[model samples]
Target: MRTDDVLEVMNELVAFVRVAEAGSFSAAARQHGQTPSAVSRQVARLEKVMGVALLQRSTRQLRLTEAGLDVLERGREMVAAAQATVRVAEGHVGVPRGRVRISAPKAFARQVLQQPLLSFLQRCPEVDLHLMVVDRPVDALREGVDLVIRLTDDPPPGMVARALMPVRQLLLASPAYLSGRPPVRTPEDLMAHSCLSLGEQERDNRWRWVRGGDVVEVAVSGRYTVNHSEMRLAAVEAGLGVGCVPDFVARDALAAGRVVQLLPDWVFDNHYQGTAYLLFAASRHTAPKVRALIDHLVAALGPCAQPV
Candidate 1:
């Protein structure tokens, strides 16, 4: 085949892959600035050239055939390799200029990401930063986000991830609440106090504490319970009860003497406190825009540094 023929075939494969990824021919058309019929024709031509049916089409949905599934997996790799090649060639010659979209939780976005991102924006004038702050799970790749910063013990599977920081959970109570209340010198003493419950409706009111090879589990009850970190912090600050909170969330209050740590030596064993990971698609690690932001975040936020 001629060079032009090879390029045409590659374009067709890309069109097919985009349609599959977008989940609709119309969506791919909108992305590529082409009509749906044109994109469909491109896929049809590729099917004819390869002598196999790729997609089973209906009015409501499009499903990939077995051949389409195999083609898509390989085609994405080829497209990524091509993109990486372009990025490498351009990086040596041009400045980093592109939009980098990031998905993060609402609370983390407001509290943690805002300052670092502001610094990153100042440093990279050519780059446009897009933040998608949601309280629920996000489909990073499908939604076209370039990176994600999430608090989890385990990062999402099949992605390149770096542990940026370890989140620490500690029990806390406002100084006002602690005053005239039973002294919480030990984990066992928590039973006599008003404990803030997380997921009070779903689980038993049991709190776990660990300190230097010693583990203790105590069953405690509370008047107020909430699922959100900020809410728990608010209730604790209002002198409602003793609540468990991430160190980052309670840092300002602790320092301001608004809330006091209950057990300084003990750590909460709940899954809420773990590590914050910087995650991105494995293929786009070398891209200039993505690489610059990842490097900046790791540097400013102190990668793998646990909160004191």
Candidate 2:
């Protein structure tokens, strides 16, 4: 191919990358202010030129073929280089200035990140941030988010992840409620008491405790079952039942004597409890603004750091 033909091929490859990263042609089009059909054609053209099918399309989501994955890495590098070139030309060289979209959980944002994010804005005036605070799942790759705060033992692949802190499940109950109920000496003793859980699913009421090599799983139910951490903490404070909540959510309550931890020796495993992680898409180039915010959060939320 000649020089102009090469440029067209590069454009098609870049479009394919965007569609793949966005998880759908429609999402990529929306993000880029283009039509889905246009994006779809670009990807199809690229596939035809490359002589290989890149994606396996399904009703719900797009899945990458082996060749598509390899092409994605190269195309991502091309996009990153183009972005860096534009930034340099725009006089943003080595400067952390721009809007960064982020996704974080609601309770974690309120309890931990909100204040630090405010402080970061004050420290870096040129960098703007958009925080999408929600408890529901958000895909960092397809959501147009620059950063994501997640608590998971195993983070999704194809992303760069940093472990910030351990999220513990602290078993708790109000002093008044615990005063009336039998002491929870063993894990089996929880069967006698009402246990509050997220109850978003059947397994939320089921909990597993780990102590060294020993493991204990219990099934306990309560009248109030809500997915919100703060709401569950409120229920525990009202002496509704025993509760297993995130340590950070129960921190203020535990310090204020509103609730007391039942078993300090055992650790519980749940959907919510895991190592807190900061994640971003893997790339040869990371923006300065995203790096700044990640460093600030790690300093504030990491172990041995002073609480805000």
Candidate 3:
């Protein structure tokens, strides 16, 4: 191969690696601050130079072929090596001063992360902060978000993910509603009650309740359906029906008696609550801004930052 041909192929390899990690060109572009169309063209050009197919693309999804996956694994190592070479030359630079973009769920952004983040920004005026509230998982590199806060049972592959805390989901209803209906003392009791459901695509309306070693899945029906957590909470508070919600969202309300917990002995199991995570690219692991934000979040969330 010609020397220039090899160099051209290497560049394509980098683009391929980015696309694979991001899962879409649009996401990769957001990370790199380029247009989605531009990202597509670059990936296409790289494929042409390499004389191999890399990605299988459709309107809704992008998948990596065998060759693409191979390239992605090797390419990440190569990129890390290249970054290490630069870091060694530049040495450590203290005090991160730059913009940091973070992505989180809409409800979380408003109820959990917003205040603490504002405090973080106030303390570090030199650091510009960009926050994006999203309901679905976002590709950190593709969406141009420096970091992502995810509530998941498992982290995605090929990224550095730190668990923040274990979250619990609670089945709750307003006291006004529960006053008229029979108390929910067992999973079977829930069948007689109406339950507001969230997430339009959710197929199972069964609620899980676990006590000791025993678990029960209670089938529930309701007149209300909403995709937003806040709306669901509002409906439950309005005495529409019992709704399962995250502890963070319901904590204050529960304490204030605005909503009462049902079946305190039983906990949700199948959609077993897991830890929240702050995920970022391995490449930016040592960047000053990245390090500072991670430290700040860890401190803010406290014991939530368990190892791994």
Which residue pairs in candidate 2 collide? none
Q: Work out the TM-score per prediction.
A: 0.67, 0.70, 0.67
Top candidate when judged by lDDT against the true structure: 2
lDDT tens string, model 2, 1-308? 35575477988888898888899989999999999999989889888877889999988999999999998998898889998888775544477889889988898989988899999999999999999998877898788999998888888787888888889989999999988679998788999999988878878877888899999998887889888889999999999999888999999999999999988999887778887788888776677888788789888888542211
List model 1 lDDT by residue over 1-308, tens digit each.
35575467998999999999999999999998999999999999989878889999999999999999999999999999999998767863457677889988777777788999999998989889999998666777889888887788877888788777778887889888888878998889999999888773454478888989999999998899787788999999998999987778888988998888878888888766688777887773366877888888888776564322
Clashes (backbone N, CA, C under 3 Å), per candidate, total 1, 0, 6
Instruction: Score candidate 1 by lDDT.
Output: 0.85
| lDDT score of residue 198 within candidate 1 | 76
Q: What ordering of candidates by lDDT runs from best to worst?
A: 2, 1, 3
For model 3, which pairs clash? Answer: 27-142, 28-142, 30-144, 31-144, 164-304, 210-267
The most accurate candidate by TM-score is: 2
Off by over 4 Å in 1: 1-93, 303-308
Candidate 2: residue 104 lDDT (0-100): 87
What's the distance in Å from true for residue 127, model 3? 1.0
* Whole-model lDDT values for every prediction: 0.85, 0.86, 0.80
Residue 40 CA error for candidate 3 (Å)? 51
